[model samples]
Target chain A: MDNQRNERKNLRRQRRIELGTQKRSPLGWTILWLIMVVFTIWTMFPIFWAVITSFKHTGDAFNPTFIPWVQFKPTLQGWHFVFITAGERTLRSLKNSILIASCSSALVLLLGAFAGYSLGRFVFRGWKNKDIAVWILSNRMFPPVAVVIPYFLFMRTLRLLDNPLAIIMAHTVLNLPLGVWLMMDFFRDLPRDLEDAAFIDGCSHLGAFFRIALPLAAPGLVAVYVLSFIFSWNEFIFVLVLGFHKATTIPILIAGALTSKGLEFWKVASISLIGIIPVVILTTFVSKFLVRGLTFGALKE
Target chain B: MKYAYRKHVIKWFFLLPCLAYLIVMAIFPLTWSLRLSFTKWLATIMENPEWTGITNFRDILFKDPRFWSALWFTVRFVFLTVVIQLGIGLGLAHLLHNNFRGRNFFRVLFLIPMACPPIAVAFLWKMMLHPDIGIINTALQTIGLAKVKWTTSVVVAPFTIVMVDVWEWTPFMFLVLFAAFQALPVEIYDAAAVDGASNFQVFRKITFPLVAPIIVTIVLIRIIDAFKLFELIFGITSAGPANATEALSFYVYLTGIKWMNLGKGSAMSWIFLLIVLGISLILLSRLRKKI
Candidate 1:
């Protein structure tokens, strides 16, 4: 009985020691929480500044105080400039951005889905599967500088400068590769049994792809489309170089605000806030897919 | 059997549009640029390029200090910003890995900056860092510190650009590392814990080695992307204060578009392309070998 009590006492002391080491100091926990709070503040500060500055008048914009509503009354003049005075140009840019982003993304999706389905599902005679996919991705890996001059001269030769179609075509060059990489992984995940079953039931291969496989990959399709749209929407140099007055995207418009004499921070802020809202909202939905797509499907959750 | 043969023929049609588009847009331009880099036609002087046989490449390689300076600036920017971003991102990922209230909210908040428009980021930062009336300077003076010339001083401008890059892209590293942290094998960590490993010991021995591959992948991709830093510099300083922040891509833009030096610009671009391709090929080959 005495030996048993001694054994129990030793076990109790070991548990106490483990608890002592594992129990984190409250001060350390507080410091970590404080760091995360500071990080969040850092992340949100510029965005918050842009939003508030958009609501401020030209005078209030330079108030230098963090408080927006309390320092002075907020004005809608910046919004008025964006919506009414500069309305035509701003709306045209917005419409152009929407059109270009949507069209390029759609074209990329259609063409990429076809290629991705083929790559993921079939074995071509001459080309290896991995080589073809890597070649497609390598096209994306090339620096945009290599193509800008030639594209400019080529577009000039074709008389397609300042055309929305021209920018759409330019954007497709970037988005299509991304589309193929993304959809290849997505379609590859799907069970081959479904398509084989459909084929055995007398459906054509293409019909089976459309009727059986496409519907199953609908969510992936949406993810790819949204991601490509965000990319095209955020793309700057292509639209800047390829399109001028008629095909100016929102990024170009925001950039134009910077070059004008006596920079209007409030006006720039308003346009910028509007420009980012769509992309920011869209990205949150597909955050998981964004990481997957950006890493070229090498990393997945 | 006939239908199967026909199916094979139809399958080729699916890849044609994308392949053709890439050929016309990507391949043709690349070859054309390769040809252009060998010529000496200024856009304003001549209607057609005059084939001058490696003269453009020679000037860019040996004579042009501007090209070298811009390339150096790009390299330094990529190195500093990526290192800082990895450090911060890893820390944030570790801190948030713990289960806690409001963790998801913080993750969403952290990701907001990554999605903001680059142009907007530039303009907002430009206004916020304006020396005389900027909020940052105001706050500094309020605390009895001297004002900082954030983007104005030549010595500080490049670093300022790096700061913006870190702010904008650190979340990308965070999200990636966070995802990687989640996907780690739980059993190994549990076994390590049961083995009485200290937290640092567990991380150093088990976590770091496994996570190193993804870290390397992030570094490789970030280096490639950061080498093409144009929009931020274009919007923020426009490579201002005597071209202190002229990254190679922006240099190419100024040469080709602003100055209309298409021949030389094309030359610089090809040289830059070869460098990028070389580096990427090396990294990719190493990655393949490892896998």
Candidate 2:
């Protein structure tokens, strides 16, 4: 009976000690949480503001205070401005951006996959292949501006300025290199035995690549596709200079709106929201794939 | 014999489209620009009759003050933005390294700026820094500080550009560095703690040394990126209250598009490219070794 009572007393003492430790340390946790909360608010507020401001009337934009509740008098005037008021210019820009981004990404993927497969599977003629890959990367090192003058002159001479094709072609120039580089890395990680097996089964080289390698590289393809698409979508310099009025993209439009002098905050905010919506949707859906894609071969053994 | 020839032709065909695109879009333009840099021509009305070989390059290098100033400005902006961005990024990554509630949410939130188009962020920040109605000024006034013209003056305009850049990009650094930090083995940290080292000491001695390579890599990348900074500054200040923010890239825009001085612009652009290429080559060689 004495031992049981002493054991119970010790248990109570230990429980109290654990509770004390837990209680005492929450101060540090609270401070850390507070800092994080503040940062979260700071990071998210501008984006939130842009979204909210998009649904607001132009007059309501200049108001000094932020209202927590959505105004019942909320208007789609800003959205109207973006879609309707800007004439067919906005629609044209959107269509052009879509065309350029999609086509460029598709081309990049097809070519990149082929190039990546070759680099991965075949031991080419010499160190020449590696040098070729390096040279391709070096092309990206040249600033877009360096080539802009000549591109402008070339496009103008060819009557291709203000055309979506110009931007598409330019975007491909940059995107292809990136795609090849990334896809090569992806292809490098793939197992060789699978290809060997396909070859042993009497499949031709292309057939084996298609059957064994291509399917396995789907995630890498998706990653490169998404990256190329986003890059082409967000690309400003080539689009801005080459496709001024005819091939205006959302970036160029936003730039034009912002720099147009008057404090058209509502319009700017609305256009910005439109510009970001697709990317936000994309991020939420494929964020997992993005993590894997972006960190390709980084943590691999 | 015909079958072998056909196979060789097919192989070349496979490589043809990409090679053609590169030649037309990249190689052709590069060479054209190099040649045009030596000839005086107006892009708007293309009647170039004279070759001024090396004059354009000479003028840009020796005679032009704007070119030198623009180069210096670009270098300065790149240096400042890269350093501050990396510092804040590393600090934030460190702060968020330990596990906590809502860690995933915080990570997602921090990545928002990077995912958003830079053009939009530039406009949003421009609005937020408006002289009279901006929240920044309002906050300053509320705190009993005098409201100064943020973007209206020469001195403050460049500073504002840098600040906006830091705000938009520090998160990028945070994301990259956070991944690097998370990749570090926890046992190393545990060993350091068991040796009675303080958190700061462990971070300084062990954590930093391990992550230094990544930090250097990020800094070099950011420096290269900063040299190409265009849209944000173009949207915000248009290279200035008084050319205070006229970076090398912006100068390329102003010269080529705005003034239509194709020869001078092409020459200036080539020079900028050469500088960036030089830096990138050094970094790329280092990166190849590290990777």
TM-scores of all candidate predictions against the true structure: 0.94, 0.89
Top TM-score prediction, candidate number: 1
- What candidate 2 gets wrong by more than 4 Å, as runs, is A1-24, A68-73, A259-261, A288-301, B1-20
**Error at A141, model 1, angstroms:** 1.6
- Which residue pairs clash in candidate 2? none
Model 1 ranges off by over 4 Å:
A1-22, B1-7, B286-291
Interface RMSD of each candidate, angstroms, one decimal: 4.1, 5.6
What DockQ does every candidate get? 0.50, 0.40
Compared with the true structure, what per-residue lDDT tens digits does model 1 show for residues A82-163? 9999899999999999999999999989988998888887777777667677778777777786678998998998999999
Worst 10 residues of 2 chain A by lDDT: A292-301
lDDT of 2 by residue, B1-291 (tens): 664454445444444566666777899898888888898877678767258999999988999898888898888888898889988778777766654446566556666676677788888877777888776787788889998788888888887878878877777777778778766765665566557776688779987999897777667667877888887787788887778888899898888777898988888888888898887776666645532
- What level of docking quality does candidate 1 show? medium
Best by DockQ: 1
* DockQ score for candidate 2: 0.40
For model 2 chain B, the run of ten residues with the poorest summed lDDT: B6-15
Proportion of native contacts found in each model?
0.51, 0.41
